[model samples]
Target chain A: MTGADRPGEFELIARVFAPLAGEGAFGLVDDAAVLTPPPGEDLVLTKDAVVAGVHFFPDDPWDAVAQKALRVNLSDLAAKGARPLGYLLGLGLPDGWRTEDAEALGRGLALDQDAYGLRLLGGDTVRSPERLMLSVTVFGAVPAGRMARRGGATPRDVIVVTGTIGDAALGLKLRLDAGLSGRLGLADADRDHLLDRYLLPRPRSAVAGAVLAHAGGAMDVSDGLVGDLAKMAAASGVAIRLDASRVPLSDAARAAIAADPALLRTALGGGDDYEIAVALDEDDCDAFVDACRDAGVAATPIGRAEAGRGVTVVGTDGAVMDLGAGSYAHF
Target chain B: MTGADRPGEFELIARVFAPLAGEGAFGLVDDAAVLTPPPGEDLVLTKDAVVAGVHFFPDDPWDAVAQKALRVNLSDLAAKGARPLGYLLGLGLPDGWRTEDAEALGRGLALDQDAYGLRLLGGDTVRSPERLMLSVTVFGAVPAGRMARRGGATPRDVIVVTGTIGDAALGLKLRLDAGLSGRLGLADADRDHLLDRYLLPRPRSAVAGAVLAHAGGAMDVSDGLVGDLAKMAAASGVAIRLDASRVPLSDAARAAIAADPALLRTALGGGDDYEIAVALDEDDCDAFVDACRDAGVAATPIGRAEAGRGVTVVGTDGAVMDLGAGSYAHF
Candidate 1:
């Protein structure tokens, strides 16, 4: 579990990917992995999968399952402004575990592939019968005319987002309920910063090329935020809404919502938040929250996009309510 | 089991990726997997893993488990000379199975991602309690001065291969001994071409850039041509020998080695045989067997490269015979 202690897959990939820092030139211990682009750019591949009781909770903390499987495949290559470049894992592991719990899940995948300049390049390991499964697959490049997509949102765009959203589904309802940890008396550093944002979720690949140089459609919320903005408003056919008091919480979610307001249903049905939700264009929403307050990150806004389709919301007597649906779907 | 029946995961990705056909440029339903490079070239990557009773046969056949998980990840992007350019799956399933056997294993992974031009892009699916596991990765591009590596073989190279190698380990020991299938008199089209090379092991990515424009070290024969040419003679440190009566066999391996010479020990330790083995340069081994007979394929040569380190077999009175300790290693 995040209590850490397990390291061997090549010494946890030489201490989590031999200290990251690369911008392509290939060479990630041969047999394959070589990228190059970056003088006009193009590439953008992506892949995701993290099952274990269907994605996390097999005692979380193999360094937050190797930083939420390399920040949810670097939030789908930072919703397409790409850049990152380098990744390819597939792990499985299960037979009575331990090879140092797969060397602390390969030193949490070589510390998020050396903190993102990536280059774990190739991978594949097996033996499974239950749980522990990863499957990353990243690679980026961008710049062949700003990437972004989610069927290029429209109906007057605007949604926004970026950081704070249901502290990773209220840190998975405080690790799957003990009656919501004595109904939110949750201290010990606000339950270890909401269990490290549901086990480490960074990937805003640092404002992916200034939201693909402004935004119009993008994604990465890993479900919830009303089921991934109802799958980016049914892949951009359009109709959004929102409001329920402009969402953005976190002062440890208003002290666990003044100690239990049904912890606002884990801030509207929690879901691992790798952030970046975008859509923008209400004149690039105040220059995209003033370029996320001059790149300190945090953006926000929360709703717009209308004209026939799903989402909706409003509340506080301002009519229309029922936003239920949450995340983790399986069927 | 592979006899069909069981589906869902979008009807096994619309029946194995609705008849695939990619090379990227928007396909596998998009949002990544685009690749473009050609007027220059570079991208290359690899990944593998197959597990289920550990790589095949828990009653195999979800279309040869989606064609040996996209032919052992396009045999590591055809041992690195790159070409395919797309792939990324991570299935795991098992639990009240049958959505058309997970759409016959997503129509055997969209018929090997439309027979190798890859493009499946996004992936991940969970739930497992019994067997079935896969984890491909692939990608390719090469050409920045023709890739090819393994520590460039030397000391008089010339080993080669390409096709026919103990019919996928005697079609997985006649698909796990049905009392050695009536004592190996085979036939049923030589037990369905040696159990479809033990369930689909092809990946030669159309002769990976003609084995890096004519070998000097290459790989991809999933362990067994004397242990992947002694890992291409210990990653080109060099010593290989072979000449076991010039390998290349198939009349269903000379009618199962004229009814058992212990089926050439299942073709010297029957591993998958995604073929390709290379080494060449004893003057480009007859122009790499005339560029695999001008691309009609089936190269052969059987072996060479010496000056010492391991792997040995001499016979016809030249003594030194130890064809034992090589293939089948997992621990």
Candidate 2:
């Protein structure tokens, strides 16, 4: 049974969301939630939304859908070098939604809330006549004037990325075309790994401290690393030179690229890869990498900032590679 | 041209939304916005969502839809006695949406942002395959432990409501069945007045300071006055005695009720009247009303809280009136 089959909106909220409400939520009865500001800290706010058939497969499990809705915003907070506080959820469910779906979504939120040390603040649930849409507004806190910014990079800054990239993009391709896995000669485990990466993102929150301490600029790579790095470079009035061969890829993405060199474009230009990309002074790069390693996060040097404009990717042949349609665009 | 006719998402944000970005928004380029904490204050958060065909007519103007989406959340902040700070918007538009629609939505948001003394902090826009959906998360600030709450009412507290009730409900009826206006013997101007109230709410934000200073408990009447009062009574563990004849009604609503006595139930039991319902000590009632009158706001006393449970409406004949389906339920 889904929440649609359960009862009215208020009852559904009590059953499915009240358990996740934090102390500030007033058991979801109050019109608004209150958050006592963390002493001497600035508040960081970010909002991300996902729509059915647009951001996820229509048949994706409710739990994974809910997790993605939250993790995407968490990735933003992580990139900002802020600690999680809580979040407000706005859900528009299509008519006749299942009770089981709401329960699964609640459980998924609980799983992540525990892992991230956050809680549900308050939210509004409404009926949508069309597709399901979920929007999450997350709050975090950081020392005043110290949050990581995207426009602080300068020439000679080392471009570093946490964890492997391109896996989720490749995963999306495989999910769209199952035959691609066999075409790439991927093993079963490798196929599962790619699919898992697409289904759920592991936000690079563990290395946030290191980024805030040592990096000059940072952002989450949700819309293709190449495009996002280009944006960062443009915002900071600098250029970036990336070594295409040095761009981190999982074993499955590597196998796919080896089978079809054109797949490399998909790996580099596809979005939904929730990795943290940062730029720092060359001297601070090693210390940041060491700190990430100490925190059990993989840190890789993929590029460097330069005194120019836009992003240039040098292929293995030592020539600039032209990336058509440089990023994933929703519009 | 609508935003769908526009080139890309980033360009859309830059052209349509960047101008509305607040000082803390970083031009909508950064992953998250940073807000400096107000000195010695707690942060208040509220979220509300509106969907096409559910919350408003599918053909409603983009600007009105946008205004309703934001103002609904603002109404919540007003009920909580929090001063507006900023808001994040999440919009989902169907493919091929026109550039004119996008521009109209932006204009609408700017109008309300300026009116409410707030700014756009950050937001996300994505494509939806079906109906348009909008979600807004608003933030505000209030002195520590001084925000109005819903569960603070006690016996002998007077129930006061801002503005008139049931105008929106009657307006909705007129909109749905144009012939109803003639049946209710409404004047041309009265019909337009009712329709306007239904289309746009005048949130009682101006009286927020007075509410915080005088009211023991408060909530916005978005879900019908009688039902919402019942909820407050339940939450505060007190009984409410309301004089049904004393419930404030707009001139248009009163005219309709005079033509058809049955319409009185519609006025008292209908929803979407964004008036603030507050509870205060009887002694403070006169002063609160005086303050509101001084501020050019209409406020009226309608009932009183008692040491009991549930809500009882005493009709003009001195007998409890039974209200069937006391509130609107989305589910």
Candidate 3:
């Protein structure tokens, strides 16, 4: 289809997005919105775009796609020790988009708004020729100078991660190679768990307060464990020594890894696992873990940061392992 | 190309966009950045996306396309009576994208960042697969409760506009139909002026203070005068009577319109003119105009708002003109 051939972007936004707008949004009627700051709070901002067939399957449920987009951005906030305020959504409809699809997308956002205690702000919708794309810019707020920054990781800092790793990666493999699920002899529950994790990330938002309280450095692992840790290490001007054996794994991921040891590389390097990774002083590691546990998020000691640069991955053999092609290259 | 097939996005960002990063961006390494609210000011937020082939020709200059994307968002903030602080950019590169093209796009943004006195905060760059798309979210600062909202227009308010009305519309036609320029007997300078206006918007950012001080309602005219006025009228619960004969036009637009009277319809109803349109009390109108003039931007009288509904356009013949299509409609 040619450009601007959709029915009406304005009407869709009015019907589907206006009701979810923040009080400051003026129901999306004004040229722009006035965002009055809550006194003494600093705002946090991040933008991540998901293009069709790149970040997700085209046939994925619209609501789930919406939730995934929202959750991934919130995952960043959670790692930064911020809580949600609102978000602006940029949705580009592919040709042949239907009104019901828009409605379903709106339903997903409305449900998340209630669940997350944030409101929709405002955004734009345009025509993307071949595929649907969603670009989300989420706003979050934290107390002054309290955000857990990536550069703060120092020598002797213990690395911590929330929830299990590798399920999303394995699930993605399952998604791409349909026969892989059966080849791995995966159980029905195992298959579902991995698929759920890949399709929808469980952002560790509940642990935001804990990160602010106890962690010195933090970030969400959207680009696999090994590569994301390497990024944090490089950013912090420190070295990360990650013990693959200590890396937490779910039953589903463990089952698949045990059946096929080669899949471990995929699990460790493949991305889309939206979990919080934190670096803290040795004295605060246990407390940070306990704090996250209090939030019902599993926190595990995965590595340590040293005064050097770059990242080192240790195999179960207690020796350095070469993690060729560290993470999913798509991002 | 398949999903995630592009070269490293992280490296590209660190090399190009990182240099333009705001102080809080942490060189684009942190999961998110902190935005400290300027003392005692309300923040204004606006997002507008331009898709290739939809917003402009795919082969448009990368720098001009980048500038257009940035200017459009800034235009909204200007109309809202806010001054720029910084912005986030979401760029989607098409298949077979080159590194040189990315550098050229960066050069464009770099030039505008200097021109507009704003910093690049943080944003996302993804593979769009087929077409390029740029989404910009701009932030501006306005003193508390000083925003010029579209809903604040009142009956008896005089409408004022900054800069000429419809040169960009005619310019777009000139761009699309090269032969039309010859038929219209257009001067080279006139043709260049129209195309320049269409390709790169000159946002009336200098008049922000004037808008805040004198206007009751305001918006940028990206969607033609007639349609935009109608929107303001509806939002403000008033009626707008536009004096079409008084609408300011560039020499080129006037020449073209005089040559073909039918082109008047395209001029009035077509859009892409990024001038500020403001509604002020009759007494404030002249002062607002004078203030804009002092900023080196011309402000012209367009019409008046009345206690009624919708918008009416009166031609030089002193009769209501039927604007068959209220706007360019592509937006």
Instruction: Give interface RMSD for all predictions.
Output: 9.8, 1.6, 2.3
Q: Model 1 over residues A92-181: C-alpha lDDT tens digits?
A: 766466656565766676677767777666565555656677777777788875678775778878788877888877877777775675
Ranking by lDDT: 2, 3, 1
Give the local distance difference test score of model 2: 0.89
N/CA/C clash count, model 3: 0
Scored by lDDT, model 1 comes in at: 0.71
Which 10 residues in a row give candidate 2 chain B its minimum summed lDDT? B1-10
For residues A1-331, write the lDDT of model 2, one tens digit per residue.
2443585789889999999999799999999999875788888999999888788887888899999999999999999999899999999887768888889999999999998989999999988766778999998888889999999899999999988888999899999997989978988998999999999999887887898899899999999989999989988999999999899888888887888899888888888899999999999999999999998998999999999999999998899999976777787
For model 1, residues B1-331, the per-residue Cα lDDT tens digits are 4325545444455455545536553434434665657768876767776877778877776878878887777776676668786666767677666766666776776666667766666566666657677777766788775678765777768787877887888888788776675677677898788877877777677777678777877877776778667766766677988777777878887788878785775686668777877787887788877776776778888778877776676643566667786575543
Model number with the top TM-score:
2
User: What docking grade applies to model 1?
Assistant: incorrect
lDDT values for all models: 0.71, 0.89, 0.88
Which candidate, 1 or 2, has the higher DockQ? 2
Alpha-carbon runs more than 4 Å astray in model 2: A1-5, B1-5
Error of 1 at B317 (Å): 20
